[model samples]
Target: MKTAICYYSRHHGNTRKVLEAMAGEGDIDLIDVTTRQVVRLEAYDCIGFASGIYGFEFHKGVVSFARQYLPEGKPVFFVYTYGGARGNGAKTMEALAREKGCLVLGEFSCKGYDTFGPFKLVGGLSKGHPDAQDLEDARRFYRDLVKRFSGGAQA
Candidate 1:
C-alpha cells in the first residue's frame, strides 16, 4: 500500500519518535507538516495523521491540515502523544475524518513527556516519557495497524 504519515511534532518530539519507529517497519512516507504542506491526499492509499496534543486537543496545524487537505473516500488513521491520559482529541479527529468521507481504520497514541504550558511549572507530567517502553508500544501499535489495514497483504 502507498501509505503516508503527515505529522507535526514539536516540543519534545515524542510524536516524531513513534512515527520514525513506524517508518522503519513499513514503506510509509513521512511528511513533517512543519516543513511540508500536504496538498493532495489522493496520491496515497492510506494516510496517518499524527501530532502532539495541546490544550487537550490536536495541535492547531494538524487540525487545519485535516480540515483543508484530507481527501474524500480515502482510508486514514490517527496517531498522537499526550501528557494527560484523558482526552478526546483522537475521537474528535475520527469524527472529522468520517465527515470527510474517509474510512477510519485505527488509531495509536501514548503518553509523551509533558513540557507545555502549565505542565512546565511542575517539571512536566510523566517526565522522561515517550521513553523506551513507550516507543516499543508505539511500534507494536503501528505494526498492528499496518496488518489490519493491509488485510495480511504484503507490507
Candidate 2:
C-alpha cells in the first residue's frame, strides 16, 4: 500500500527519528508539515500523522494540514512523541480523522528528549528518548500498520 507520513518534528526530532527507521525498512513517503505547503493525501492508501506533543496536543500545523487535506474514508494512524507519558495525545487527531470519514487504524507514542519551557532549567524531561528500543518499537508498529493496510484492503 502507498503510505504517507506527514509530521512536525522540529522540537527535538523525536518523531522524525522513528520515521527514519520506517523509511529504512521500506519506501514510504515522508511529508514535513513544517516546510511543505500542500500535501496530497488522496493518492495514498494510508496516512500517518506524527508530531511532538505540544501543550498536550499535536502541533497546530499538523492539525490544520489534516483538516484541510486528509482524504475521506481513508485509513489513518498516528505516531507521537512527548516529554511525558502518553495519555490522550492522539485524541484530537483521531477525532478529526473520524469526522472526515477515515477509519482510525491506531497510534504509536514514545517519549522524546524534551527541555521545553520550565523543564529547560533542569535540562529536560524524557532525556535521551526515542532511544534504540523506542525506534525498534516504532518499526514494529510500522510493520503492523503495513500488514493491516496492505493491498488497499479496507478496515
Candidate 3:
C-alpha cells in the first residue's frame, strides 16, 4: 500500500530521527511540513501524521495540516515523540482524525529529548532521547501499524 508521513520536527529533530529509521525500511513518502503545505492527502492509501509534542499538544503545523487536508474516510495513523511517558498529544491528534472521518489504524509514540520551554531548565526531559531503543520501538510500531492497515487486521 502507498504510505505517506507528513511531519513537523523542530528543535533537535528527534522526532524526525524516528521517522527516518522507519521510512528507511518501508515504502513510505516523507514530507517535512516546514517545507511543504499538504494540499492533497487522497493520493495515498495510508497517511501517517507525525510530530514532536509541543505544549502537551501536536505541533501546530501537523494539526493544521490534518484540519485542512486530511482526506475523508482515508486510513490514517499517528506517530509522535514526547518527553512525557504518556501520549496525550497523540490522543488529541487521533481525536481530530476521527472528527475528519478518517480511520485511525494505530498510533506510535516514544520519549524524545525535550527542548520546549521550561523543560530546558531541567536540561530537558529524557535528554538524548528518541535514543536507540526509542527508535527501535518506533520502527516496530510502524511495522505493526502497516501490517494492520494493509493486511486488514483489526484494532
Q: Which candidate leads in lDDT?
A: 2
**1-155 in candidate 2: lDDT tens per residue?**
78898999987888899899877766689999878666678898788998989888998889988998898898999999999756569999999998998998889899999888899999999989989999999989888878876745476
The pairs that clash in candidate 1 are none
Q: Quote each prediction's TM-score.
A: 0.89, 0.93, 0.89
True-vs-predicted CA distance for residue 99, candidate 2, Å: 0.6
Candidate 3 segments exceeding 4 Å error: 85-87
lDDT of 3: 0.82
Model 2: what TM-score?
Answer: 0.93
Residue 31's lDDT in candidate 1: 83
Error of 2 at 111 (Å): 0.5
Q: How many clashing pairs per prediction, in order? A: 0, 0, 0
Q: What lDDT does each candidate get? A: 0.82, 0.87, 0.82
Task: Give the CA lDDT, 0 to 100, for residue 34 in model 3.
Answer: 76
Window of ten residues with lowest summed lDDT in model 2: 146-155
lDDT of 1 at 14: 87
- How much is 61 displaced in model 2, in angstroms? 0.6
lDDT of 1 at 43: 91
How do the residues 113-154 of candidate 3 rate in per-residue lDDT, one tens digit apiece? 885777788788888787888888888888888777768753
lDDT score for residue 45 of model 2? 79
TM-score of candidate 3 on Cα atoms, chains taken together: 0.89
